[model samples]
Target: MKKKTKKSFIEYGVIIAIFSGFYFTGLHTEVLGFLQRGILATGLMDPDFDKDSGHAVNTDYPEADFSMKLIDSKGENVAMEELKGKVIFINVWATWCPPCVAEMPGINKLFQDIDKDKTAFIMLSVDQDFQKAIDFNKRKGYDFEIYKSNGGIPSMFSSQSLPTTYVINSQGELVLTHMGMGDYNTNEFKEYLKELY
Candidate 1:
């Protein structure tokens, strides 16, 4: 009788231990999967700064004043002049471009990190349908303002390619223009913005 009681106690202990191990393992796996998803979703997860390609030309950016119509997600019209006294990042992109889609989250991250009172970011969609641009902004939950450029307005800025970004200083001078997608939220880009102020 004493031997049977001891065997029964040992069997219960083993069962409890196995159950605890499985429970902890399943919990850990779930937590790790959630962390991985979070990292992949946010642009701030990585700090890799891509160097500007040699093709970037340091042309003297001309001082120009132009008016464009920006429609918010709510369909309200915002004028370009209303954004004066703020550093503006004007990105020209189309929804179909893969590089443009890839660069969007970085731009959104940069917009979120900056001082909003002093800086303004605008994405100008070259898509034919303005509603598509509005939908994209809604789906992405982007914080930056988006504008739909008129037919001749984009040509005035000398933007020849999709995913081009122009950084305008506080004084409204077009300063830096990048041809392709880049890590706009990097420390180096922030330093360049600091110089403008």
Candidate 2:
């Protein structure tokens, strides 16, 4: 009888161990799935502007003469020279970039609220598919002039990352280059724009 009781205890122990293993495995899988879904929902795989480590570009690079064709929301061809004599904010972005999408609405609002007669906001998409940019702008209902960088306009400006922006003075000189997006309507940006005029 003693031996039979010992065997029964061991058999129950094995069953409990197997059940615990399966339970833990299932819990781990659920946790992993939840994490994956959260990342996809937030679009966190795209590049982000690290505000803490970001450095401002000094107005020291030699003036570069570059021109490109821009397509408006209505699919009209516009020359870059049309923006001459105006303080221009040129943004280099891509549709797949999350930070670019987030900053775009703020830039649009800035354009609408500011004195458009003096300042012009230029959005140049570096996406390989020009149609993707057009579709994105259309879905977002954006009003800024969208352009394709066919002549390497982004590389000419020394942009190393997506969503880079350059502030040009009225004299057609690059004054400031921001590696990341900031508050476009803030006093800091307004003051910077005022310097061009």
Candidate 3:
């Protein structure tokens, strides 16, 4: 009877371990925010920064055209068409998203380095509370061109993900679509942007 009870305990332990693993992997809430911060600290959560694969160019999904009034921090309307002739980098994210917060610094750095005249960095906030987004950016001292989506978001730039990014070329062509956080401070990514600009 003692041996049978011991076997049952081991089986239950194994089951608990399996359940815990699955739970951790499935956790997308603030419960995993600490884990994400740790990963970022260790430089393990860099953006899947790529230039070769469907990122720098997409022949099929060319001409990414969209008309949306992106409201600036000063309550000014910034039309998407104003940036048509420039290489546009649009990041769809919210202030509350852990992955979005984690990847922002790299994006800010990229924005600082890129040619402002030739490239337009549009950080579209998906936040329900637009003030919170602006406040977060100000508190973080990030100088991204953060805007609120005031109209219909185009299919080429829309995603179910909280932190999706799309790169549109100078000719208003869709070049890349990144579904999550990425390390945007890479040399390869900069070079690709240079080529695009």
Candidate 4:
């Protein structure tokens, strides 16, 4: 009995040590994000346009704040206003965020499948060191355009979560907002976005 107990303790210690190494080396974020990708694959986290998600469909959607500023990879400035008259999909995220990393692949897939002429997809990175985001994108080989905030984020774009998403229609009204990770690359979501414009 004592030998069995000692073996169990040793096994637990090894597990703890492995986890500690992962955490200190910052590998846990990707590991956790990989685990979360499985959950995202379940399609339970996808944004629902109909349900009372943060801003309900029936309630008045405030005019989208076009004051948000962004800097593209080429160091070009962009304002929300520049994307007017088009359906917009804005995702606020960070490299250290596990859920954000998890949903990114789906977003890129959606970006590839969507009609770019009618819709604009903005991959907004909130990382303090924007270079980290740029490097991560390069490492992942995602083709979606990435941006970092150039100035203060507008009040309407603010959320209590890390991976929040906002959808604005061509009419420039805030139509939908979802807080948290989501599997956005789907026929249903694509159709819903097309319907927005």
The best candidate in terms of lDDT: 4
Model 1, span 55-114: residue lDDT tens: 233345555464766675566777778888677778888766655676777788888888
Rate residue 57 of model 3 by lDDT: 52
Give the Cα error of residue 19 in candidate 3, in Å. Answer: 21
Clashing pairs in 3: 47-182, 47-183
- lDDT per model, in order? 0.68, 0.66, 0.78, 0.88
In order, how many clashes per candidate? Answer: 0, 0, 2, 0
Sequence-dependent TM-score of model 2:
0.63
Provide the lowest-lDDT 10-residue window in model 2.
46-55
Overlapping backbone residue pairs in candidate 2 total 0
- For model 2, give the RMSD to the true fold: 11.7
TM-score for each candidate, following the candidate numbering: 0.65, 0.63, 0.75, 0.92
Better of 1 and 3 by lDDT: 3
lDDT of 1 at 187: 69
- Tens-digit lDDT string for candidate 3 (1-197): 99999999999999999768756764343445445656665655454544543334556656787687789987999999888878888999987788887778788989989999999988999888899889889988998768998887877677999788888777677777888777777777888887776
Off by over 4 Å in 3: 1-58
Candidate 4 wrong stretches, greater than 4 Å: 51-59
Write the residue-wise lDDT of candidate 2 on 76-195 in tens digits.
777778888787788888776665665776678767776788888878887888888898788778777787754546455657776788777677766666675444645555655766
- How far off is model 1, as Cα RMSD? 12.3
